[model samples]
Target: MIHQSFLDLDYCARVSGCETCRTFRRAFILEQITGRDVEFLTNPDLQSPVYAVLRIESSGDRLLLTSTPTQKPSFAATVALNHEPRHLANDPTKSGARLTTDFQELRRVVRDCHDNHECSSRYRWSRRNPTWLLEIMDNNQVRLVRGPKSLVDYVVLSYSWGDPAEMPAAEWARIKGAGTKTRNGIPVPERLNPFSAWDLPETMRDAIDITKELGFGYLWVDNVCIPKGTNWDTEASLMHEVYGNAAFTLVASSSSKATDRMIKERLAWSHRSKAVKLRGKWLHNTQMPLDKIRLESPVARRSWTLQEERLSPRVLYWTEQRWYWSCPESQVAELEELGHVRPENKSMERRSPQLFLELCRTGDIEQLHEEWLDIVEAYTPRDLVEPRDRFLAIAGLAVRFYSAKSEAGGSFISEEYLAGLWRDNFARHLAWSVAKGANSRHNLQHIAPSWSWASLPLRMETKTKHAFKPSEHFRFISVVEEKEDSEKAMTGPNFTSHDSLSRGRTMEERGRGVKVVDVEGRFRRFVSDNAKQVSWDAIEWRRGKRVGFDFGAFPGHDLFARHEADGRIIAKDAHSGEIVGQLDYVVPDEALKSPFTPYVPCGGEKEIMCLELGESAMLLLVRNPSWGHQESYRRVGVAISYENRKGFFYGCETRTVRLA
Candidate 1:
């Protein structure tokens, strides 16, 4: 829990405190700046017998008033200084004084502090001489003086001089930016290059030289190259480029020469001779028990026996090189079959700077190259690049590790093949899927389709302007027309009139839209031929009822009713034994209706219902004279109308949902 404290401004003002009490009070006031606790003492300064008025001398430049003090009033006190502003009152020497110069308050303080003997006398001569020569002038214009020697002294005072010499300016500055700026007397370098060099340990000097000779212009040597002050942005950016551009990164294994020798002579040799054996019955073929095979037979003499089968050979191969096992494929399997106590080696799970540095010192660039290659080969490019791009490096690394395991376990597919597979699977389909995936993650609540498509890795078509190709991997399938393989096909009608109208620029612009799917099963086109139509049941909610079929709620409500020649209502209501209305007339597929009508309904209960035409035509409930809301309802139910167009809006679909 967070704690708080109260500031007794009244008590402080009455205290007529001395320097010590004043200091305590000042600290207390400052603590109040952040609404925190602070302790004050009225008798903190026992040395002085004067009972001076002690109060917060300044609060945003005004004194915090409290009870008056009983101390003898001197000329300084009687000056009414406390009644003036804080700046005027605080300085007894120049209370209420004003300057005509352009100097701001801070500069004024600096000038005052410099001119006042009391302030100037506070600084002491350095016991340790200044590294920088002094450049001082007593002119009134002069305040504080610092020279080159002082600069060097400042650097030295802030940093240490280790066994190594001064660091480059860029590196030192980098460290400073990284919030780890060190005190070592190091000059920060300003620029970085691939050819940058560092002071390597005497033992690794040769290795360092080799790296330079190999054309590495910018090298990252952690010890001397990365400054203690490197900024986070620069560090993060550099991390990517450093890991990618390095021809080979050198790892330091040991800090001392003696430890290096020990690793090579004693540790390396013992690890090389160790081995593991497999003695399981599976080694002898479990179906053919060892006892069943006759040892005396000539076949047995030439063929492998139980003893030979059980003896799985494994020889550590590290003596020839560094610390790494190099067992043959056969023995590797035997090691696994034995279970738990197989070949032993140090874990390579953690990244080791020491190990890396050791490799660098030994000039094992080849090993570094091979190991890096192994890492890349084991992980798919998508697995590596996508995660990296998305700021999910940790997850990416885990995926890479798993990929490595699969490769090591004898999978025939390479990382390259996996990348190719991803491309092939998603190439044609990525456009919509990628957008949808990102959108799904952006939603504030659970949305339709009830599935997250983002993680599915759906491929999109390269472009929407051209026809789709079989070579393309995936395409976004709209729920209504996803199974169809052709370009935006419309079922039911030609919509020759609508051909001139441009679809809205985007799905959002279309509002509640519709998708036009080609429902014509199998037929050839002829101008005189009747427009094809696929029969499907459309379920709708009835108006003024709990639920059930009615077309009044659909967009463009008075559709079939008034438009029919035999305009009338049909169907019984569920709640009450009354006609629900509908099916008064039906529009045939033959006659074409006017495509454009200025008489669009304003979508209110009082608007005139649409006029319908043709057999089994849809019905509508038109008022006696089409008036206002209060005098409503003569008919209601399924109302279909005649129109040549198929789709109503862009993203919206007109398809019926299957109840089965």
Candidate 2:
């Protein structure tokens, strides 16, 4: 039973001929449904007394009718709904109010995006099979389901996990067991028992309820859907497809943690009369803009969510004020001002990775290299829980770039991945220096070879401004051949050839080795001790056109201290005194007994190698100490190698040699 006494049916019929009267009638219906008083009035600017248009305004809600005299008389309205004050109380669920009156419009937007958006057809990675989804079953239960069948519509949840320690081990165990169940010690393919919504955290429970409300039966939540341990790496690699293929990605932007609720109550007020009198004239104060509210959300600032948002074809942002819809076609908010202004036909250019992919199609290797560098610079500062996952996290983006290239009939230069650097552009790619404000020491764990940028824990920048510039004088000799480790390969997704996913090997499992090359026929070798201590020493120096002068204090403590004081320890040119290169050094743990102190020499002899840059050269100090049965070298420091008045380097015969 419902109350309808508030409506005057006979009075509504008497003035039904008037358009304003009809508008008031519709407003009255809304008031009845929402339990809020609704009024119909003319536009404040309209001065006509006979047929001025009417406007609808409630205490905290607004519906602007778009009907003119010449236009058909219809009740088409643009509604701007906000959360009620009671919803914002400490207990959000305690309020019995409806979540929103704009649910129909939200559903329409999603349907349009799915049916009309071009991205849905272009990005079909998510359509592939063997993918997992969390199916919301009857009785408030959830079951993990896998698919190799036809395309199924599913929703994905994007949220921050906050502190990892807060995750319940029991919930994880239940999910793990639910994936596979056995009856009488025999495995069976049956749905797992349903779990109550109360069992889940607030953010996830809200997401599950929203999914069901939107007519979606399946949902994907990373923590619950993704398996733990070794499977984490394999599942992480599929993040691109998982998000991109989703029919809708629900962004819990306002929630700071997994336990935080996405839907909450907030005070809503009319912005039409919020103007203040300033200097005698009324000046309306612009409410907090929509973009500001969106960008400032907790999830937007996170590192992992960056890829998730960009990859998803359709994203529905749930904020405190109102809902926001973003897809390939357009971005719209409940508020008129927040809606996206349709762009010209060049919307495709705005699509990320697509833009990068287009660049790849042009065969502009230089531009591609530059774009890769930009991606690296942007991604380096993000926080990571495991340092070893640095390369794994970004591998999906690389896969997409290569996939686009292959589609354009472009051939890959090389299939081998050298840590983070590729062997195809070895010469230019190897010219990387430690970026400013990055860590100055190397990680003790052997994540990558010493020559690769991934070897050090610090952020890196390219030494040369132009990545594709030709180095005619340099020639690559040979790289040490290391076989992939089968044991480590099982820990993560393997990086195989682009054409054959089954044949590729993971970069983590690849053998460790250094690339050997020659500069102007002169073979220069960089030696290291266990890949951690890789450096070169300055054996000889020449000022101008004079013959080379050998310093008696070479490899000694006093000379090392003097060079360090002069700031030549890094890549400072001895002649011009310009800082051109960077270096990373890790001191041995003090607890361990070692023969040598910092910059202090033991009985071991030191060596040096010259690394030629464009117009300058870096003199690296290398130390090869015999510890046990292993022969290893450690990099101490680097100084600028000055050119003589005659030429940059003394003529030397080219020779081939192996470097470890």
Candidate 3:
């Protein structure tokens, strides 16, 4: 017997698996698993929409699964109804109506996670004194005064700085004049008066409002927190600790510009697909996926915020539609209706801060490689207001990762930092490429070595399938670059890891390449077809190569892709005439050096320069003897060749090609 009709349904969105949805959807889900397709959903003549909202009268959090009376959902079909009301009469005041970032709900969510979660406590680090902090409630930037308060629990803000040039002249001038502003390229750090809240940007003011509402006294806004100086490079070193030790971070995900408001009116309905009703009621609104909600934002696309997001143990993300709080174990919202549905881990790498940190703590070396690759994918493809900060932006993360593994009881103590690539199976990280259809370019500032992904600005291809193995276990993988360890705190590297390089050589075969360790104990990367022996351009190889390359129209040199893309570029062996191996990226022709054809070994015509940090394809060689770094190469693009052990760069002399 059915006790409930599951009426009063709304917001049947793409990512909106709301509370009512789960219970109402249970009937449709079960029927599909055991019965036939839902007729109302598939009926052609109806041309009407179906919407459901589940209502349960239970004392406990869970539904009444086993009861004296059995219950299930009931569905009814009906036609469209126009003039649906959004109920925009009263002031929202961040209420349950729009799933606002209201304080009462935020407090409840925070209290619940703290009281019930284990990971919340374990994910924290020992508290430390913040370098410099903003008094959110007050309009002052002050250091620790003569008081017993040494360790302060501060809230941090992560937001897009927007284009400095376009900022209000008064605000930008005040910021620069306040102290050495990082964005305005102020190279000199000097003693200056503290800036008032009135001088700060709108986002910062909003963040301050949020911090104050959360009952925090001190706030850390990058530009304001750091003492005014061009020498901030040294001060930047403590960023990891600054964020790691914060009480929590407020991320303005929806704001693309500093002037834009973080909190805005919510869009509850869709205009794209017309609203048809079920049982002559309930409107339709597709749910946005959690990943899109987190990543598809202006702040998410900025490179510098990566460190801020990853290091903070707890974060309150303000997306376009609603507010979400994420900790080690859970990502919850303030919507009261959401209380009906239990949120489960979707296994999104960036969704959980502890995902990679846990790997470091447990000394999971093999898993760390894949996680780092994901970080690279997420970091690159983002637009940097000042490209010079490329390496500097991610330097904190590199330092944090290294520090984690080098702790007293950690693994890979021998792991060395070579530019952005790790020392272990250093060859595997060498395989990187712009996402298919994306483009790559040299960092005019030349912030990193040619061999390092830091040397370029490009969107790295995001890898979904796990093909990563312990590089120690691989035989053909390899680099030695004299890297500048996190400059006090930053760098300029745009890099990413592609799919698992072709299956590793047999245990014995992996060691086929030469091994030369100088005093540094670094492995030599075999140089493939160094100037003379290039066979990629050979007529035989060209004849065997067939093109399925989609390098022109992929999703905008994007970073942090959905689990949707797997672009394949295949290479063939003229001898076998068989579709043999995969190539991750091909530098387009415009970047190719003279005398080199697309078939000659690099990206096809339009031949853009590239670098290969090989796990999969053989890509661009980025080196310039002219820069005075002998035998050093700049990566034009990253590529890896798999399956065919003797592909383009196969069987070559092992040499350490320091990428610029």
Task: Give me the candidate number with maximum TM-score.
Answer: 3
Candidate 2: tens digits of C-alpha lDDT, residues 1-660: 011121332144234433233333333232211111121222233221222233346653443333343455322233333332112212211343244435666777777767777757765564563356678877787776665387788888887665444557764444334333445533234434455665667788889987887789988887656533325566655666777677878988657667766655321221111212322332221233434444456565445665666557677877654567776556765433233424455553433323443354455655666555555554554545566766666655555544444444434334345555554555555555443323333342256544555555533332433423433455555444434534444344434345522223244224222332222334343222212221234533667877343434333222211122222232221332222223444333342354432222321222444444333443343433433444333333332323332143336344332222
Error of 1 at 350 (Å): 22
When summed lDDT is taken over every stretch of 10 residues in candidate 1, the lowest stretch is 154-163
Tens digits of per-residue lDDT, candidate 1, 438-478, equal 11122211111111111222121111111222211112222
Which runs in model 3 stand beyond 4 Å of their true positions? 1-101, 137-149, 164-196, 263-287, 336-350, 408-412, 437-445, 458-573, 577-641, 644-660
Q: Using TM-score, rank the candidates from best to worst.
A: 3, 2, 1
Per-candidate TM-score against the hidden true structure: 0.18, 0.59, 0.62
Model 3, residue 206: distance off in Å is 1.7
- Can you write out model 3's per-residue Cα lDDT over 374-465, one digit (the tens) per residue? 78778776777676666567655666666555553333245555556666646566565444523233433245553455544544544432
2 versus 3: better lDDT goes to:
3
- In candidate 1 the C-alpha lDDT for residue 520 amounts to 11
**What do the candidate models score in CA lDDT, each in turn?**
0.22, 0.47, 0.47
Clashing residue pairs in all predictions, respectively, total: 80, 21, 70
Tell me, by lDDT, which candidate is best: 3
